[model samples]
Target: MSSIASQSRSGPRRGRPRDPKTRRRILAAASALLNEGGIGAVTMEAIAERAGVGKPTVYRQWPNAPAVAMAAFLESTRPLAPAARGGRVLEALRIHLRKVAETFATRAGRNTALMIAAAQNDSELAKVFRNHFIMKSREIGRTLLDRAIASRQLRSDLDIEAALDLLYAPLYFRLLIGHGPLDAHFTDAIIDAALGGLKRRRRT
Candidate 1:
């Protein structure tokens, strides 16, 4: 399971043991609302009614609609298959990028773009989204890069931060801008180009 799943359930909770079914219902309801009406459509009452639960029940699980929306988003983005252990790091990264591109073309991805746009004006949402979701995902990317560097598969002088940006930023830019196809071909092209710049130089 991805850390996103754990993060959604993180921090202290003050409620009875959470029922998985109830949680799924709530997330599903929240996702539906987001798809139907964007970020503004999801409300505690709306989620509860859609989930067949009371407002208090929703509150018991999440503080507000944004939190719930973020949770729903996180759930959708999870299972972003990690690089296979002991495989060539770049190969794993290639696979990972493909998954990212595929997901970015999904309804969840559309909702993510909307939430990010909405976050521009909502500081609290922006903070939580960055701290919990974006940062966590970056950490995952960072770990993979660290592995590549350690194995000497990438240049020792490689700037991990910039490398990550190179690997993923294009997909996101396309995702947000609606410019091009977010498909395997694009995934391969982007990763190949980025890796071409980052790979270790073979000595003659």
Candidate 2:
């Protein structure tokens, strides 16, 4: 049996061709609703009303509000911390992480925290959030790690899984726990610390 966290996207329904403009409006509306009132406010009716479309229009694209909310989060955040390619891998990753810190320090971060709390009780929401948002974001980070390792900037024997955790776990910890500030300074500290352990050691 498929786990709740492994649900896949629904197939397209037979209807009018999906319009790019309408899709954008729906996603934007959902994002706004999530930011303003958390995931509780992102119902199909609310999204349709906000997007100036019918309920069926929203339903046709997403099976439920959680799906729409996750989609909106991904759409809105994709550009904020895009994966860096080429150039010095560490420097590129540092710059990328700074962007991530800035993103986490905003209202979106609050919405994410809300989503996480909500997902604890909503299995469907948890699935989509983990598979789509969290895993996808980690995939980008993994690519950068692969590049760094290939370039020998990082220790060849590094454990990618543990290394990824070390690199990003603190940011999420701060974001979720709210104990410390999530900013460029914090990002630099994480990079410095993670790199200190990840970098290849000089042999005497």
Candidate 3:
């Protein structure tokens, strides 16, 4: 769940051995702090206190606050199931978007927003975030688009990256700008709008 890129260090590592429960608590605590106060508020000592674990416990898993926040952000986005193949493309898309919408409304979601912001200046962190979170989401979208194209239901010439942009870019846009609701209906509407153009035109 830790998404922060690891750093090479030249000394004995300090921290307790990893435990799943402890790790979950720490992530949950990190998420709460992140949601309540943004990234600036998540200190190592604060996470330790919130998670009810020693500072060493947190250090064992994450070297810094960004690391903790990244891990929590990954956990938040991790629950979404990829769009199922062989299902109707639109419905599958709707479900995928719905899960994304639900997660986007949370603190973990907000932490992810922070991750995006942090990555703007931190190239190393940007690489890690793209490799794990963004890459996985893109892969999922790619698979679904491939199936859609093969089914003759969508245009064969569809641009994979652009298609995904149509599906996801708007959601992230709304999340950042707060111009509209990220609700279930909004997800459905976006899917409908994208498919309207993505679908193959009927021949007369």
Candidate 4:
């Protein structure tokens, strides 16, 4: 023949040896490990063992424990999307509050608090947490406020930034401080108080 029978594979396949299911398992394992044992416990060795993957696999995916932990944490604590129905801003706000309250009342919340404390010491972790959680919350709240404005439910002249802070800061404080339960009634009361002061009054 043409001396072309000696073709050989050059490198590893373009895809990883493991499939998506294995990757998901690794992420899930990392999340559970962090939740149960905090960031300190998310070593590559431990994550590999927990995930039933090799250490090389973990390292190949994440450069460091913080990166893996961040990914896992974000995966575990993913927030629900804001509802899309029209004319239900207040109701949506209430639902959001209740959901956040429930989150604050869970073991996952405790783990998140620990992550916050850890972030105080780790700048990278802090950046990751802010980007994944804090900024996302701000975006969601801003969208809600913008929608309300577009619908004329809120005053056209209302300062949306200030309004979002006023409406959400109290709830965040409540969540962090454990000052009170974040129930629907509490959310309704907060919405009522905020709307009374923020909404445009009708012409006489």
| Ten contiguous residues with the weakest lDDT in model 1 | 3-12
Instruction: Give me the runs in candidate 3 sitting further than 4 Å from their true place.
Output: 1-16, 82-86
Tens-digit per-residue lDDT, 1-204, candidate 3: 223544211211554445677777888998888888887788999999999988876776666777777767766666455646666865676787787778777766756776667658766665666676666766777777887788787899988889998898888888877688888999888888888899999999
* Local lDDT at 48 for model 2: 95
Give candidates' CA RMSD values in order: 3.8, 3.4, 3.7, 9.4
- Residues 1-204, candidate 1: write the lDDT tens digits: 223334357621666777788888999999999888877788898999999999887777776787788788877776354755775877877878887778778876777777777668666556665665556666777877888899988899998888888877887789888888899999899888887889888879
Question: Compared with the true structure, what per-residue lDDT tens digits does model 2 show for residues 96-117?
Answer: 7887777777776667667777
- Per-residue lDDT for 42 in model 1? 87
TM-score of 1: 0.80
Candidate that beats the other on TM-score, 2 or 3, i.e. the better one: 2
lDDT winner: 1
- lDDT, candidate 4, equals 0.67
Q: TM-score per candidate, in order?
A: 0.80, 0.82, 0.81, 0.74
